[model samples]
Target chain A: MTYCLGIVNCFGIVIAADSRTNAGVDYISAYKKLFDFSVPGERVLLICSSGNLSMTQGVITELRRDIQNHEEVNLHNLSSMYDIARYIGHKSRQIQDRDRQWLERDNIDFQCNFLLGGQVKGEEPQLYLIYPQGNFIQATKETPFLQIGETKYGKPILDRTITYDTPLEAVAKCALLSIDSTMKSNISVGPPINLVMYKADSLVVRHTLELRLGDPYLAKMRKLWEDFVRQAFEAMPNIEWQRETEASVEDILID
Target chain B: MTYCLGIVNCFGIVIAADSRTNAGVDYISAYKKLFDFSVPGERVLLICSSGNLSMTQGVITELRRDIQNHEEVNLHNLSSMYDIARYIGHKSRQIQDRDRQWLERDNIDFQCNFLLGGQVKGEEPQLYLIYPQGNFIQATKETPFLQIGETKYGKPILDRTITYDTPLEAVAKCALLSIDSTMKSNISVGPPINLVMYKADSLVVRHTLELRLGDPYLAKMRKLWEDFVRQAFEAMPNIEWQRETEASVEDILID
Candidate 1:
């Protein structure tokens, strides 16, 4: 299991991912799940992946091979962010298909998903969630985020806080907090966390941070968020349990 | 799809559930998911269910039938809360087995889960989560809550706020807020919400509240939580994005 998310706001986009990967309880290991493909002045592409590790590695290997071989349709040759999403999705599906038969025979899964976020030199910064089936969906102004795995525990915070007009710094903080919530509740998702913040028109990645388990700043932020949440919960108004009539209250009570 | 939870604290136990049931998006309807069986001075049993509606209804019907027919192992005749949990789990599995073949032939799921909490005359109050396989686990002092169906979106709050010594009223509020979070993130779980609070050794449920979609207290609490969360997010320290060494930051940057 993994937790990775991408947020798109007015200032730019932020992509964050957890580094824990496990084949089973005894086979746990750390693997970097975030990859960067940036041409300093021309384009910037960030890929955050989750799902089957083998399939993700296969897709990444093919992507790099294409770039080194200068294939007709490589990441560096892509004209738009959407094209890059399609290309990644295509590669993911191809890799999964190669192992689908044998993996399924052994009752193993061969699917993987990716969050593609970045800017092509002439295009605006964008974010896309590419599915294992080779289909993809782009983020919209109303829903300015896309998540890949172990999403639900961290989603309520994002649903309430993120928007297209949110500032870049605030968006980065929310992304880290979202991953933090997931890490606390789920053991499959652990640190070090890889985070990247890209300013819209700058064709270079800036503000990249890798937070390991006991990093001081990460620890401080986690404590602060936990304390704030407790305070918030303690402050909510209590339910008026005595105001309702007896008959209505006992409607479902069997005696 | 449903979201129901049972919380046991020092003062008592609080049980809450959403009322939405659907065969599919086109066949949505409302059905109460919480049931109570209290014999004023003798015993008080609460059952909150999630999963296949028909199976839960069947199990409930069997329980009532046993009581009405004066069966040797009915709810009223049970010796302890643990026995009651075992009875409910047995009935649930029996019902599922009855429909298993036919349901599977049509690709339908006949599984269901339950949360059983109550106090019998001479026994201490308890909470149990009964799985589809007819096995159950009781909640402990360290973990005082049990949840079933659509649980992830609402779990973080409970993980952060609930404790064995939490006041009954505060526990009730936390349970409501947990369900509220689930409803906000999942359409499959919705109002009107059912809540019941039982004081330890009382052997009866004293406070029950049904909150409709726009109940004033519910509305106020939701707004306050949302506002407080936003305020908390805004108060967090911003990440110092530029202080790190450029070389370390750019190590993963592909060009």
Candidate 2:
């Protein structure tokens, strides 16, 4: 399992992912799920993947091979973020097509999902959640975030906090907190979190951080968030119990 | 779709549920999911249901009918909370068994789940999650809460705050917040939210609330929680950026 999120707002874009993957409870391992395929001055592109390890690796390898081999259509050459998303979705579908039969024969799930966030030279920063079926949906002004893989446990916070005009740095912090919430609720999503923040119109990636297991920053942030959440909960007003006597009085009056 | 939660701590048991039911987006209606069958001064029995509307309704109807008709084995006659859980599960299984073939022919899901929480005269208060297969598991000291239906959105807070030692009132508040979080994230779970709080050894339930749509208290709590959560997020420490120059120096050293 994996949890990857991409947030695109007026200020910039933030993409984050957890590194843990498990074929089963006993077969868990850490892997880099975020990849940077930026051209520095040309465009900024980041992809976060979740689902079948072999299938995603195949898609990533093929994408890199296309770039290294300078194939006509590649991540570096795509003119628009939409086109790049389409290319990644196409590659994902291809990998699934190649292995779906074998996986199905063994009753294994071969589906994979990807979150592609980037900015091309002329367009605004964009985020897209590419489906396993080669379809994709982009984030918009009203809903400025997209998530994939173990999504629900971390979604309420995003729904409550993210807006199109949120500051870029604050969005990054929310992304980390979102993943931290998921990690606390689910064992499938663990650490070595990868985060990248790309400022709008920059056409380059400058800020990146990888929080490994037992990272002090991660521990400190977790402790602080937990404390604050408890404090917030404690601050919530107590429930006003509706007394049974009053209800009975109302009931007798109705009768 | 539904969201129901039951939290059992040393102080007492709190059970809460949303009242929304839907066949699809087009067909949403409200029905009470929390039912009290408490024989005051004897047992405090509260049950919350989730899953297929017809199946859960059928289970509830039959449980009521058995008690009304004075059947040989009824909920009122059950000696322990475990037996009561088993009795509810048995009724649930019977309903599913009756409808299984017809539902399967149309590819409809016939499964249902129940959270039965209460105390019998001789036994301590208990909470059990009864599965579709007529089996159940009790909440334990290590994990003092059990939730059914649309549970994930509200789970992080529970994971962060709930324990066996939590006060009953606080647990009740947590249950409300948990359901509120779910309602915020999902449209299928909505008001009027039903809540029941039972103090240990008080077998009779004296505190309950049904928060309808646009209830002032509910609105106020929602606003306060949003404010507090934002304040909490703002209070969180910002990420310390690891400069590219530092990373490059470390890379040079490694090389």
Candidate 3:
């Protein structure tokens, strides 16, 4: 399992991915899932991949090849963020095609998904959740973020707190905190985390942090969250029952 | 969809369930998902269910019939909470037997699950997570809470805070808050929650709250959680980049 979350707002973009992967309880590994393409002073785009290792690795390799060859569709040369998403989706589909037989015969799905986002020189920053089917959708104010992989576990926080007005740093924190939640619930998604924050129009990979275990800040945040939760519990309203509707064991029994 | 969560501790037990059902995004309705069989001064048992409304409702209806018709086993006469869990599991399998054909033909799953707990006379408090196969597992200090149905969204806080020493009111508050997270994220669970909190040895349902929409305390807690989130974000550690390697993007491309 993996957690890849990105929030793009008026300020910029925040993207994070967890490194844990597992093939059941016995086999676990750490593989960085966030890849950034930043031509310093030129462009900074982020790609977070999830799903089957083989399929996503294949897609990433293809994406890298395009960069090495300076292909017209490479991340550095894309006309818009949306175009980048389409390209990613296309690459994912291509990988699936190569494994089509195995996918059907062995019930193996190369279920690869990628989230691509960033800004070009002239347009506003954008984010897209590129699907395995070679289609994608951009983030809008109504839904200002995208999450992939083991997404359901961390979605509630994003749903409640993410918006276009959210600051870039706050978005990054939210992404990591969301990942933390998943880590505790699912062993397959333990940290070290890859977090990238891009400032709008910066044309540089701004603040990128690698949070490994024992990172003091992450530790403190976890503790504070625990403390806050305790406080939240104390603040809740007390139960006000109209009356105790008591029923006897005999009264609840049948004839 | 539905969300039901319970916390068992030395202080007692807290169980909360949302009453929402949906056959898709458009066809949505509300139905009670919480059932209780309490013998006021002697024993108390609460069952919170989530999944196919038909399956869950069928289980509850069957239990009611068992009580009125003096079926082979009934919750009211159960000597232990563990026995109650087995009884519910048996009734669950029975319902599945009768409805399995309709579900299989339509390609729909009768995925009824339950979170049942309470005190039965002499035993200390207990909690169980009942699966569809008529098997259940009890909660322990290592994992003091159990949730069913749209549960992931509401699980992070429970993972961090719940334990055997947790107070009855605190656990109750956590249950409601967890339910709130689910209600906000999924449309399948919403509004007017049904809550029950049991005090050990009292064997009586002492605390119960039906949280309707627009409840002041609910609104306040939601806001406080949001504010804390915002605050927590600002406190995240700053990213530090050391003597940067001439760059890694090139290596990624070349490789």
Candidate 4:
């Protein structure tokens, strides 16, 4: 299992992913799931993957191979972020199709999902969640984030905090907190977490951070967030119940 | 869909459930999902249901019928909370079995999961999550809560806040926040929320609250929680990045 998320706002886009991969509990391994393709001044594309390891690796390898071989439509040559997303989805489907039959025969899943986020030289930074079936959806202003794999645990925070007007730094912090919450509840997702903040139309990755267990800053953030959460919870007003004689009234009536 | 949770602590137990049911987006309804069976000074049992509405209703109806007819092993006649849990599980399985064939023919699911929590005379307060397979597991000291249906969105808070020693009032508030978070992330799980707090050794419910969308207290709590969360995030230390030239030291090392 994996947890990868991408947030797009007016200022920029932030993409994050966990690095743990497991064929089984006993076969756990750490693999980098976040990959970046940059042309320095022209375009920059980031891809975060989750699902079958072989399929994701294969898709990434093929994507790199396509760039080297200068395929008709490679990430570097794409005109828009949407086209890059479509290309990644197409390549992902191609890789899965190559293995689907043998994998199905062995009762293994050949599905992989990807979060593609980046900016082309002339276009706005965009984020897309490409499904296992090679279809995709872009984030909108009202919903400025997309996530795949073990997503729910980290979602409430994003739903509450993220907006198109949110600053890039704050969005990055929220992404880390989101992954931290997911890691706390789910064992399959773990450190080191990969994070990147791309400024809108910068055409280059400016800030990136990888947080592993015991990393000082990660440790400080975790402790601080947990403490604040507990304190906040402790400070919330307790439900004031009605008097026993008046309990028959509506249940939410307070005092 | 539904969201129901039960928390057991040294002080007592708290059970909460949202009252939303949907056959489809077009066919949505509200039905009470929390029910209690109390014999005054003897025992108090609270049942929270999630999953197929038919199966849960059928199981509840059967349990009521058994009690009314004075069956040998009705809820009031059970020897322990575990027995009552097992009885509920048995009835759940019976109802599913009765509808399995027909439901399967129509490609419909005849499954329901339940949370049973209460205390019988001479027994300590307990909470059990009964699966659709008619098997159940009780909450433990390390993990003092059990949740069913649309559970993930609400789980991180419980993972962070709940414990066997948590005060009942705090646990109740935590349960409400859990449901509130779930409702924020999942449209299928909504209000009016039903909450009941049972004090240990009392064998009777002491406090219960039902909160709806426009309920003043609920609104206030929601606003307060959201505000506190944002404030907490703002108060957290930001990631201090290393200089680009020194980035090779380590992914998380600060300058």
Candidate 5:
């Protein structure tokens, strides 16, 4: 399993991914899941992928190949973030189609998903969640983030904290914390986290980080978050027990 | 979907459940999921259930009927908490077996799970998670909690705060927050939360709560938790970006 997410706010976009990949317990290994396909002054493209490793790696290779070959419709040639999302989704479908039957024979899941977030020179910075079925949905002001894989454990914080107007740096912090929460709760999602922070109109990737296992900063942040959570929990008001005649204790009941 | 959990620490055991059930989007309804089956002074048995409504309901009915009919092996007659867990599991298996074929014909899921927590007079306070296959695992001092149904979203907090030495009230608070997190992240798990707190030697449950939708305390706690979380996020140290000369931005990359 994997955990990857992208956040787009008024100031810019932040994308992050965990590095753990596993076909089974014994096959667990660390593999970078985030890729940069930026063209310096012309465009900024970031992708985070999850699911069948072979299929995702295949899609990424094809995407880079299209760019290196100067294909008519490649990530560098796409005019809009929407088209890039569709193109990635299309490549994903083709890869899955080629492997689905053999995988189905052994009852394996052959699907993968991607989070596409970046700016296309003349267009606004946008984020899209490309589905395994070759369809995609773009983030809007009301919903300014997209996540792929192992998403739920880290969602409550994002749901409560992120918004379109959130500052770029704060958004990046939230993204790291989100991945941190996931890594803490699930063994499948381990460290060597890759994070990128893009300034909305710069059209050039500036800040990127890779926090490997046992990194001092990661440990410090985890410790601080845990302390804050414990403090917060301690501050919650205790349950107000109803002051009534204790209900008959013999009333063993069912719903 | 449902979210039910049981946490047992040295102080006692805290059990909680959310009351949302749905067959389809149009059929969502509220129904209690927590039950009290304690026979004062002899034993304390609390059960929280999740899964196919019909199957769980059937299992509950059978358990109740066995007790009322003065069967040879009813819950009150069981000498140990382990036997009670097995009895409940047996009852669950029976119910599923009876309904499996009919449900499977239409591709419906007939499985359900239960979290049983409490103690018999001569034994220690314990908690067990009964699987759909009717096997159960007891919570140990090292891992003091068990959860079922829509569980992931609510798990991180429990992982961070729960332990054998935590206070009973604090454990109860953590259980509520866990369920609250799940409700916030999933529409399938919703309001009218039920909670019960059992002291180790006192077999009868002295404290219980039923927080209906829009309850003042629920709203207050949610607001406070959100505030604290935001504060915690703000307190988190900003990522320390590597100082390497910015990598060549033209390197459109793969892998």
Candidate 6:
């Protein structure tokens, strides 16, 4: 029950992930899901994970280990965004191999998914949704954003709002609205959000900020959105045909 | 894939369901998911099914057969809304008993769920979410709704809008908003919505409306909601404290 979303806009890339992780209701804890792998001015990539905490953390650690030994393939050494997806797949597969047998024995699904996006020094910004099976799909003009875990509740706003030509700031707004919707419905997705944005071509990490508990702006946005929706609900016209026990002028109809 | 929702409002009840049912993309068909049994002034019962179409259809058929047989237990003869729930559960279990052995041999999990809500003569209106296991839970003043199948996309707006005391017309509006959101994200849940409403204690249905693909009012509401979201998006502040590319804002200040 996690939420991680990434959007590739004309100006750059936007990445957002919630911090809640749970093994069960009692084991709930905060775990940072966003990882930065880019070298300033050389490459900038933000990767977010959602699902099996153990499996995702395993993949992240594997990537970090790969980066440490330049001889091994990793995000820092990869020349293109597509290679990033392959490398992530390879690592995820490696970890799945270790647990696949055990997971099947217990009837526990080894479920995990990830959103990997950012710029390599030479290429345009890119976004990819890496599935639990160690395969991945890159976002294109038709689908300029990718989400992983608990995605449906937040999808309509994203499907309607995001575009390849959208400005970076507006992308942030869409991402937040998406998160706002998810957090409102799911208790397991409580947030102290990890939000990051990378400017196109600059290849350096520009904004990698965390809004922890008690963050003012998120609180304000939640209230403002709720208030707006309440007002909108009131503004909708009452059904012209429905009757009242005690009829009023609004209930009157003419044929 | 399907989406079905039910709402209990001050004026009455609103139930709406999509008509799409698919075994696979190539096997998709339009099958109605909503069924109502109303005996004017005596009782009104609405049922929406999501999951295995055959299993749900079986349950529907069994209930109708009971009615045809003049069975002692049917919505028409049930003493209270809870009794109606038990009847649905009993029949659902009967269907499962017939199907489970064959389904298990094929290695497919048992999949089915139902949401039943309405009023019987001499009893208050009630809503219940019936599980495949024959257990049920009723909605309370704090939670005045139930949803079945592909439910998440529509759930957020419900969290933001529905209450036990919400007016009947407003409940219908909210139900549309909910189903509309589900349809926007899920292609498997599509057009020709079946929406019904019942006022408390009146027994008979008050409104059983249809919203088709080209319905003008629904189309207008979708556009208005999208526009309103766009306006709300623009009103939010662009975080000024975001780091810049020329020099890391952190480097400039921290150094």
Q: DockQ each candidate and list the results.
A: 0.42, 0.42, 0.37, 0.38, 0.44, 0.35
Q: TM-score-based ranking, best first?
A: 5, 2, 4, 1, 3, 6
Model 3: runs farther than 4 Å from truth? A237-255, B235-255
Residue B170 C-alpha lDDT in model 1 = 80
TM-score, per-candidate, Cα-based: 0.94, 0.94, 0.92, 0.94, 0.95, 0.91
Residue-pair clashes, model 3: 0
Cα lDDT tens digits, model 4, B1-255, are: 899999998999999999999988888889999998877567889999999998899999999999999988899887998888888988998999998999999999888999999998899999999999999999989899999999999999899888888888888888998999999999988899999988888765768888887788888888988888888778878777442333332342221
Candidate 1's C-alpha runs over 4 A off are: A242-255, B242-255
- Give the alpha carbon lDDT tens digit for every residue of B1-255 in model 5: 999999998988999999999988778999899999988778899999999999999989899999999999998899999999999999999999998999999999999999999999878899999999999999999999999999999998898889899888888888888998899889999989999988887777788999999998889988998898778767777778864345564453321
Docking quality class, candidate 4 = acceptable
Per-candidate Cα lDDT values, in order, are 0.88, 0.89, 0.81, 0.88, 0.89, 0.81
Candidate 3 per-residue lDDT, tens place, A1-255, comes to 888988888899988899988887899999999998777656678889888998999989988999999887787788777777877888888888899788779887578788887887778888889888888888988898999988877987788778889876677777878998888887789788988888787666757788897788778878877777677567665645545567643453333
**Ranking 1 against 6 by TM-score, winner:** 1
Q: What DockQ does model 2 achieve?
A: 0.42
Determine which window of 10 residues in candidate 3 chain B has minimal summed lDDT: B246-255
Cα lDDT for residue A72, model 4? Answer: 86
Model 6, B125-197: lDDT tens digits are: 8788999988998887778888888999999989978887877777888888888888888888887888887
lDDT of 1 by residue, B1-255 (tens): 899999987888999999999888788889999998878777889998988989999998899999999998999898988888888988988999999999999999889999998898778789999999999999999999999999999888888778899888888888888888888889989999999999897776778999988889888888888888777778888787643445542454454
Model 1 scores a C-alpha lDDT of: 0.88
lDDT of 4 by residue, A1-255 (tens): 899999999999999999999887878889999999977567778999999999999999999998999988888888988888888888988899988999999999789999999888778888999999999999999899999999999999998899999888889999998998999998999999999988786666768888878788777887887787777768888797542333332342232
Off by over 4 Å in 2: A244-255, B244-255
Comparing 3 with 4 on lDDT, the higher-scoring candidate is: 4
True contacts kept of 6: 0.38
Q: Cα-based RMSD of the predictions, in order?
A: 3.6, 4.2, 4.2, 4.7, 3.7, 4.0
Which segments of candidate 5 are over 4 A away from where they belong? A243-255, B243-255
lDDT (0-100) at residue A191 of candidate 1? 96
Candidate 3 CAPRI category: acceptable
Task: Give one digit per residue, the lDDT tens place, for model 5 in A1-255.
Answer: 999999998899999999999878778899999999998788899999999999999999999999899999999888888888889989999999999999999999999999999999779999999999989999999989889999998898798889999888788888888898899889899889999999887778888999999999888987898888788778989899663345564453221
Task: Judge candidate 4 against the unseen true structure and give its global Cα lDDT, from 0 to 1.
Answer: 0.88
